[model samples]
Structures are given as structure tokens and as C-alpha cells.
Target: MLDDLFPILADPDFQKPGSGLMSFPAYVYVYPPDEEYAFREALPQLQERLRRPNVGQNSLAVNIYDALVEHLEEKTLGGRPLLDRILEQEEQDPEKVDRQVKRHARSEEFVEQVASRFSAFAQEEGGLDRSYVFVHGWGEVHPYLRASQFLDLMEPHLRGYKVVLFYPGTYDNGEFRLFGELSSGNVYRASCLNERLEA
Candidate 1:
């Protein structure tokens, strides 16, 4: 099933305007939560496959975790520097510091910053025909960055490529069950991607 999806991802024909796929340059590959490690380990092979000359054009793959960490390191949160705030919170309340940091991390401003930084990273890779963006480290960011929220904000700026999001979740009956966590709610949906994937 994973291999089947790769051709669709690398095919520029599906990326054209009114190609019957989603307008937004995003697609989701649902997988069992426990298989996350295997899927990540296979990324290099997948990247190699997508890089083949016959795949049509040069493509770039980015692990969002690394991008997010780089963004956090370079930016500030609230009025204080991000790292400084986290350290201060840790000293004042070690147990609750993570929660505090997550709360700040998920702020609209911060999420937009992340989106912007990701766009910049993609642009830096030069003009590629497609981009494969992997959204991992869900456990590390948790409530700070929900997949749906990030995609919704990112859809606007991420254009001109066939972008596939490898989601460790289930897609069923028009809803998304994120990370297989019951508490996370299966009511979420990415309208553009879901409508076509479900078809």
C-alpha cells in the first residue's frame, strides 16, 4: 500500500490545476500507530525512490521535527527568549515546565512562525518539482502542534508541488483518528485531502 502511494506522490500529472485531486498540495498516508518506527526507518528508501530520474522531477523531503526544533532555537516566546523562558520555568517548576512550554508553543503566532520557517526551508532547497513533508515527533510536541491545525495553516502557502503527509493515524468514515489516541478525538478532518482520499 505504501509503495502504491509513492507513484501518485511523484506524478506531476496529479498536481495540475483541476486534476481532480485535492486543490491543496497535501495528501495523507494513514498507517497503524505501532508501525510509526518502521515507516520512519523506510523514509530513506522512499526518498531514493522519489529521487529516481523517471519520477519526473527533483523532489525534496523534510522531517518536520528537525525544522520545528530549528525554529524554536532561533525564535523567542512571549517577551523572553524561548530557551530562557523554558529554563526559567524549569527552575521555578520542573514538573509543570513542559506543559507551560507546550502551551506557549501552540500559540497561533508560534504555529504561523513554524509554517513560515518551513516554507523558507522548502524555498532554500531551490525549485523542486515536489516536496515530501513528514510529520513526526507527535509525542514530543503533543498538544502543542496538532496535525490538523498545522495542515490547515500550512495549506495556503505550500503550493506548486505534490506534498504527501505520512500520518500515523487512521482515516475512516470521513474522520481522522490521530495517533490512535482515543482522547485525541477522531472528529478531526482535513477537508481537501480527506474528500479525495476517501473517494
Candidate 2:
């Protein structure tokens, strides 16, 4: 399936930023949970293929895990990274830590931080006109941050740039089921990249 996706990704005309079938320039590439490892291995190759000069586009692959780590580590509590604090808290009170993480992930502050990171990434990659961003590492942030929420908040930032999210789940119509089990709710704006490729 990923073999078929490469061409679409490399095609600047098809994945044209803000000019597709959907109003938003974001897309979700849903795959089975079991293929997670395979997907990870293939990601670099895919990015490399998209970055080739012949592809006629510049590509940037952002791992959500790395982005979240950078964001959280900058947040220090008592001279230690917030992630370190969370780890310690998890050892003593797992449920409490979980609740705190979940709450923070759902907050407007968190969304703004994420949006800032995304904007920086785009600018660093030579702006939206020449960059195609592929985002993965959803599992690392799951339960704490849902794909629906992330995509909804990211829709505005996605304007004028093609951003494809590598989702380990099922997206039927508008609803997204993370890992094909937990419902991340309906993501109405972002089109399914697989569907677009097929069409």
C-alpha cells in the first residue's frame, strides 16, 4: 500500500497545498496497527524519495514523538524537565500522571505550543510553497493526545502546505478509530490520503 502512496506524495500537482478536494491541506494516511514497525522502517525511504530533485519538491518528515519531547523537555519543573517530573510522578502515582498529561494535552495552551512548533518547522523547511511535511509517531502521543484534536488544531497551520499524518488506525468517512479500537472522534476537514490516491 505504501508503494502506491509514494508517487502521490512526490507529485506536487496532486498534493498541491490548499488546492485539493478538501478546503484544508492536511491528509491522514491510515494503516493497520500491526504494520507500525514496517511503516517506521519505510518512512525514511519514502522521505528520501520525495526529496529527490526529480520529485520537484522539498520534503520534511516530523516525528510527533521528537516534537513532543522537545516541547515538554523545555518545560521544567523544579530544575528538571517536565518529562522527568512526569516519569517520577508515574512511579508514585500512575493514574495522577495520566490525568495530568491528558488534561494538558487537551488544553488550548498545548495546542498553541504545537502550532508554534509546526510554524517553525514550516519556516525552517523553506516555507509551505516548497515543503511537503509527513508526520508520524502518533502512537507515542496516543491516549494523551488524539489525532482528531491534533488535526483540528493543525488545520489552520496546514493552509498553503501539504501535511500528511501517518495514522495507525482506521478512518471511515469522517470518524477516526485509533489503532482501529479507540474512537478519536470525527475529523471532518482532513481528507483521507488513501482515498485521494485511489481517486
Candidate 3:
């Protein structure tokens, strides 16, 4: 949905030259979904629920499910999601099932590469600030990816700054283990979302 990305896309801080999330696959982030509407009305209190603890089994509200179904309505070159197709073929052929599993594994690898580029160090007026990287692991499959993987992916881009990885862990929660680890010895200037956002 066009409205879905406007908050992150239109912000200059997110669209800056070196640290922009939109810098890679510029169009896909803004992929226009037809019949776009606000999720606030449809999902009701879904956002508030995401901010809570013990959010059982990921209580995905109706609108988010609908949006996902809509995203699958238009298939890309990736084929009709190996998970969906494999489910249908589970009883048909076991060998073909193995192939589908491999495809999904590769897709995840591609996701890691794309997510990596969204990281960079910010420059301060005095000098370079702590090197930081943001791993936008939103959506269903993201929580499965670890914070260390994000930190490793961000390693190359750190350059002169210390690499501090961002991991919005949990299904849709903030488990700042990555930040905590980076700041343990006070070695890096890692901070929470609000702290980093303000910086």
C-alpha cells in the first residue's frame, strides 16, 4: 500500500544519501497495492497489541492477514511462495518438496543481502559517530533471523565507526539483545530505538 510506506519513505533522515533504506530496490519499497486503505480502521488495536508483552502466537489482526493475501495476489519472479505451493504439493511428490525447501533457503539469503545495505554510520558535526546498522526485519519471517546475523551483515559497512546492529526482535517486539551486547563493555555507542532515533 502506498500509505504504508509514506512514513518511512518521505522522511529525509531515512532517505538520506548514505543511510537510506530506500537506496536499494527503490521501487519495491513503494510497491503500490490497489485498493489501499488505512489499517487503523480495519485492524483496530493491532499496533497497540504489538507493543505489549506475552503477545500470544502473534495475534495478527485481520487487516494484516488481508494485506498479506493481497501481496500474494500479485506474484513476482519468485513464484507463488514456496510455502504456499509446497503445502499444496506435500502429498503429491516428496522429492519436489525438497526442491521447494531449497528455494526458500535461497530466498532468505537474498533477503539478508538486501537488509544489509540499509545499514551505515552517521556523521556528526565534530566527527564520525558510532557506526550503526538497521536491520528492518519486519513481517512474518523476520523474527527468526538473529541479531548476530544482522551484526555480521553490518560489519563491512561500519568503516571508521563501530558497528552497532539494530534488531527489532520477537515476532513484532523489541528485544534489544544486540544493543545490550554491543554496549556491555561500553565499547560501542549502541542505543535503543528512541535514543538512536533522537541521535
Candidate 4:
């Protein structure tokens, strides 16, 4: 499974900044949901192989799910914890709370803010470099934040590195269908990534 990514991972030109091989400085690696464990196990080896001096010492992988949770815990929107507000209103006013939650979660500003936090994890200690950012955990933050929105917001901040978003979904034609949920229409055709690796 890991063999599928070797071609792109080993390409020196792909690692260079502003190479223009792809419209965006990122790639998509699609894998089955069941392969998540294997993917995690192979991450260290993959990082070791892709590691470059200028990239910094931080781990290559960034779990967006974890980042989102941290953001929710540390910051409050509308002067209150988002989760607490949602839950507090759930019992007395479920519908209203739902509407409020949707308004806050799906807003452009919220998405950009979350995306900014996620992108920060990919940066080098003191500056940026030619590194590989392995992004995962799309499934954890699905309805609240779409993968496409985050990717769009991340484009500007990710130009200096090669980002590989590990999507547990299917890329058919051009649309990426998340978690094989055909009814959801969670299909995203992001033009940012240079290539797609399937497992």
C-alpha cells in the first residue's frame, strides 16, 4: 500500500518550492477507512524517508481532528465554548441550537480560522521549508467543516511545503466522496493537490 506513494514521495522536483508541477503545493492520498491503522503504523517510516533538514524537527503528520478539538477547548465563539453552548441549548431549544451551530460552524470565517490553526502545525520552528505535511482526520470533523473548505483556506499558507492530505474516501472522476457516503454529496474536487495516491 505504501509503495503507491513512492513515486511522488521520491520526486525531488515535487519537494522544491514553487516548482509549479501542480497548481497547488499539495497532494491527496486516498485510502480505505480500514487501512487507517496501517497508515498510522507506516507514518514514521514514511516521514523518515521524506525528512529534509530545512523542514524542522516536528512530526510530519497533523491530525486536523485533534487541532479542531484543541481550538474548541481553548477558544470560544460568541463569548462561550461552542460545544457548551450547543449542548446547553440542546434540551430546551434543539432546533434553534442546531441552527446556531450550523451558522457558526459553516461560516467562512470559522472555517478559515480552523484551517489557519491546522496549517500552523506544518510550519518549521523558525521559518518555512520544503517539507511534507501529512494531513488526516477529515472524518472526525465532517459536517461542521468540509475538507474542501479547509484545503482552500490552507493553500496560501502551504506554498512552501508538499502537503499530502490522507483522505479515507474514494476519488472518482474528479470528486472526492468522503467515507463512501454517496448520499451525502460530500464530493470535493480540489484543484490544489498535484497528484492522488490510492491504496
Better of 3 and 4 by lDDT: 4
In the range 36-63, model 3's lDDT, one tens digit per residue, is 2332332334333322343211111222
lDDT of each: 0.59, 0.76, 0.32, 0.62
lDDT of 3 at 74: 39
TM-score of 2: 0.87
- Worst lDDT run of 10 residues, candidate 1, spans 183-192
Task: List residue ranges in candidate 3 displaced over 4 A.
Answer: 1-139, 157-190, 196-199
User: Which stretches of model 2 miss by more than 4 angstroms?
Assistant: 125-129
* By lDDT: ranked, best first: 2, 4, 1, 3
- The TM-score-based order of candidates, best leading, equals 2, 1, 4, 3
lDDT of 4: 0.62
> Candidate 3's error at 68, in angstroms?
13
Query: Which candidate tops lDDT?
Result: 2
Compared with the true structure, what per-residue lDDT tens digits does model 1 show for residues 1-199?
Answer: 3565566656676635335445665566667778877877776677777677666444455565565566556777676566776676787787687676566565666667756655665556544444445455554456666666667766665654445566676676655666765333422433334344446
TM-score of each: 0.72, 0.87, 0.28, 0.71
The residue pairs that clash in candidate 3, if any, are none
Write down the TM-score for model 1. 0.72
Backbone clash pairs in model 2 (N, Cα, C under 3 Å; residues 3+ apart or in different chains), count:
0
Global Cα RMSD, each model: 4.0, 2.4, 14.2, 4.2
Off by over 4 Å in 1: 17-22, 76-81, 91-99, 121-128, 183-199
lDDT of 4 by residue, 67-140 (tens): 66655555687888777766777899988976775565555666577556545655537443435667788777
Q: Comparing 1 and 2 by TM-score, which wins?
A: 2
